[model samples]
Target: MDERLKTNLNLWNAMVPVHVDSKGYRVDKFRSGENHLFPIEREEVGDVRGKSLLHLQCHFGMDTMSWARLGANVTGLDFSEKAIEAACALSAELKIPARFLCSNIYDAPNVLSEKFDVVFTSYGALCWLPDLKKWGAVAAHFVKPGGIFYIAEFHPMTQVMANGGGVAHAGEAKKLELEYSYFSTAMREFPPGPDYSDHSVTLEHGSHEWMYTTAGVVSALLDAGLQIEMLHEHPVCCFQMFPFMVRIEGTRYWRIEGDPIPLTLSIKARKPL
Candidate 1:
């Protein structure tokens, strides 16, 4: 692993327990049969019953096990060993039959040989990967011929604005101020701190992340021989990505009330038979 990735792995390992206990992850509700998946993903990746599903960067396997609950044979993979162990424990305790793997996404092919009917990942996943082309190939590789790969993630544009820029803190007007580039040549590195899931835990190591343009992500998948099926951008995100955003009443969606920009993006691509 690259040194940066190792540091990220350590950060993620530290996050497992914190995330498991966090109310946002809904570990308790998940145990009570609530699916952790958002509506966009559930609807876009529709009816996974009886399908073989592979979830990459599946933190603690909540979504992976949710797919299993819907009748898909599921396998969840993450670079964090602690996360995978926790996932395995959850699977056993709930009797939700699912497989969990502790391997970096790039090395996944070397550890697991099976292709699946669906290859899935979501939310905060792509940024952790330093190389989008390699990540694309890994995604395309696991998707069986004719199978689909799906992702619902924060928009790249949002990342550009969200990267220490344009954030309206609490009690301030929500407005976008572009502080980061849409096409930067370098990866952004930051001192490790509280992550989105849990704010209580802090890490000792620095973190690394890369932002990808919408075109860049789409092109990589195309180059990997996956046909783009659907690409959708939504104005509301599943979480309050911006500090000043508010959750829409009676919905799991959040947005800056009057200031709307694309906050989330979803794509579905299919491998040809």
Candidate 2:
């Protein structure tokens, strides 16, 4: 593995416990019958019952197990061994009946050899990978013929904006401003700090991520031979991606109080029959 990848792996391993304990992950709710999946992705793909599902970049397997709760036979893969271990422990503890494998995405095929009825991935997953083409190929590789592959992710247009470095003060909207280009191959570096679930508590995550245009994502998946079924973009996001965003009730989604912009994008594609 590349040194950068190894470094990121170490950080994710260290973060597994914190993530499991964080409110953002809501592990307790998942145990209490709260499905960790968003309606946007679920409704679009519809009905995974009894289907074999492969979830790539499945962090600690909460969502993967949630899919099992929804009636999909699930397998999760993550680069961090600790994350996989934590996920396996959680599965055994909860009796979720899912499998987890710890391997780099590029090498996952070497360890596991089975096609799935659904190849699934979602939010904040694509950016961690550096190559979209390879990522798409991996996803397509796992899908059985006539199965579906789905992704719900933050739009690349939104990714161009910078969210880190505390914030830059403005007179009215005093928050972070864009310090980097909207389209660049710069891997962001963060200091040791709080995990997303519990920001008040300090943790360490020295990791790297990459950005891709929404079009780039679509192109890559298409290039991998999946036939497009449905693609949708919504004005609201599932998370508070920006400091200036507001949460909408009932929906439990965040919205920018402007003329409305695309916050997240979802695409569902099918493996050929």
The prediction achieving the highest lDDT against the true structure is 1
lDDT of 1: 0.87
Which pairs of residues have clashing backbones in candidate 1? Answer: none
Reference-based lDDT, each prediction: 0.87, 0.81
Q: What residue pairs clash in candidate 2, if any at all?
A: none
Q: Tens digits of per-residue lDDT for model 2 on 8-118?
A: 887788778877887777788877878888888878878889999999999899889888988999999999888899999989998899999989998888988999999
Per-candidate count of clashing residue pairs (backbone under 3 Å): 0, 0
TM-score, structure 2 vs. true: 0.91
What is the model-wide C-alpha lDDT for candidate 2?
0.81
TM-score of each: 0.94, 0.91
Please write out the lDDT profile of model 1 over residues 1-273, one tens digit for every residue: 899899889888887888898877889999998988888999999999999999999989999999998889999999999999999999999999999999999999999999999999999898898889989999999999999999998888887774332221222544666778899847888776665665556656667889898998998899999999999998878876777777789888888777467888999999999
Residue 64 shift from truth in candidate 1, angstroms: 0.5
